[model samples]
Target: MRNLLNFIIRYGRWFVFAFYITISCLLLVSNNSYQQSIFLTSANLVSNSVYTGASEVTGYFHLKAINESLQASNAILENEVLNLRHQIDEYKTILADSIELPPVAKRFDYVQATVINNSVRHPRNYFSINRGAKDGVKVGMGVVDQNGIVGIVNVTGDRTSRVISILNETQHFSVRLKDTNFIGSLSWRGGDPSIAYMEQVPRHARYQAGDTIVTSGYSTTFPADIPVGVVMNRIHGSDDNFFILKVRLNSDFRALSTVRVIKDEYKSELDSLQSFDFSPTK
Candidate 1:
């Protein structure tokens, strides 16, 4: 208590000066309209700046959720586009007869997932997503990003799944030339992440620089017309029967953060065809 008294005695004059200064400023602002307006304006600016900085920090943390939501919406829209493309072509040729055909079912849906692990510099590259069998991500389901194709689900666990990336040399995807409707098998040669090779194209298949290549819909994996890559050029194949076109993939594997797993509605029924009981049995 004696030390406190000494300390106050030592700084009492300075404390008085500070107290008077604060009161003087407050009274000056309160008594003068111009000073009060200027004070309020400066205070508002400071408050706004603080609020803006805080809001930016909060938004940065929520970026992942926002991105995942956007990717999910985009996947749904892309699926709808594919279904519409199929329906438009079919209905345009109808003759308006009372033909009660089966209703065209919605063929695709998406499961949004984050790419937790990824690779591009390997002979057989694979990536892992945060979704699994519990999320309706099954083996052989197609994986895609907003830009284009990513891979196929290879193995699935209860909460995670690995995908055979499009860059894998052992993996081949059925893709078609958008201009020619010529279907081919897309494979990678294990060097460039951006490049792949499409084979089984006819020698006379018309292609120019930057021709679009998309899913052929011949497989049960990917839906029809999902973008795969763009043709860069053609190379001489070992056999003269087919042309091998070099392609630039649309998805940048290095930048894959979020992806969508494609769920084809008819995939199970289509896959069950091979196991159908056809022989005369009991």
Candidate 2:
């Protein structure tokens, strides 16, 4: 305290001068209309700038909450769309009066999850979602984002699950040309996140660049006609009999955030049936 007092005494004259100068400037500005106008304008501009900067900072922090809300909303809308489509099909059948049937039961149940971790540069890329067995997620369940197919669940824990991303070289699924029934095998050979390869396509199959690809419903994991990608190009395979298609995937794996885990209700039953050994022991 004694040192602070001594310091103040040393600088007291300068401090008094500064205080008088500040007061004099304020009085001059207040007395002069033009000066007052300029001062108010400058003050307003500074205040606006400060307010805008503060608002942007607040908004940046709130984005995560906003995104999660949107994801939940999208899940609800997607469920509604699925139900409506099924209802429309039911109505069409009823109008035809070909066969009286109840509304088709839903085949896929969606579990909305956030992508907590992802990889696109690896030979065997995987994704981790914030959902697990407790959330009805299980191994072999198909995972998809808003745009298209994403991956398949390979492992599940109590509150987290790992997915084998479709970008992985080892991942393979049956996809068909959207305009026809031509089915092919979808896989990835790495190096690109937005592109994948489709093979085993018969040369005779009618397809062209920009043709859309979708799930073939051959497996119990994903439902029929889920959007996968569009054909970018085609080349003759080593066999020369099949066409290797370059597909531009609809889902942007690099920007993946929210996804849905597709739960096939009859998957267990289908697996059990397929597990039966039909060959006789030699």
TM per prediction: 0.65, 0.66
What's the TM for model 2?
A: 0.66
Candidate 2 lDDT score at position 253: 79
Give the per-residue lDDT digits (tens) of candidate 2, residues 126-195.
Answer: 7777677789987789998877789988766666676788988877999999969899999999898888
Report lDDT (Cα) of residue 252, candidate 1. Answer: 73
After the best TM-score superposition of candidate 1, give how far the Cα of residue 16 lies from its true spot, in angstroms: 84
Clashing pairs in model 2, backbone N/Cα/C closer than 3 A: none
Please report how far candidate 2 places residue 205 from its true position, in Å: 0.9
Model 2 clash tally? 0
Runs off by more than 4 Å, candidate 1: 1-103, 277-282
lDDT of 1 by residue, 113-230 (tens): 8776667987878777767777888878999987788898876766667778998887889999995678899999989899999998988788898889999989888888888889
lDDT of 2 at 110: 96
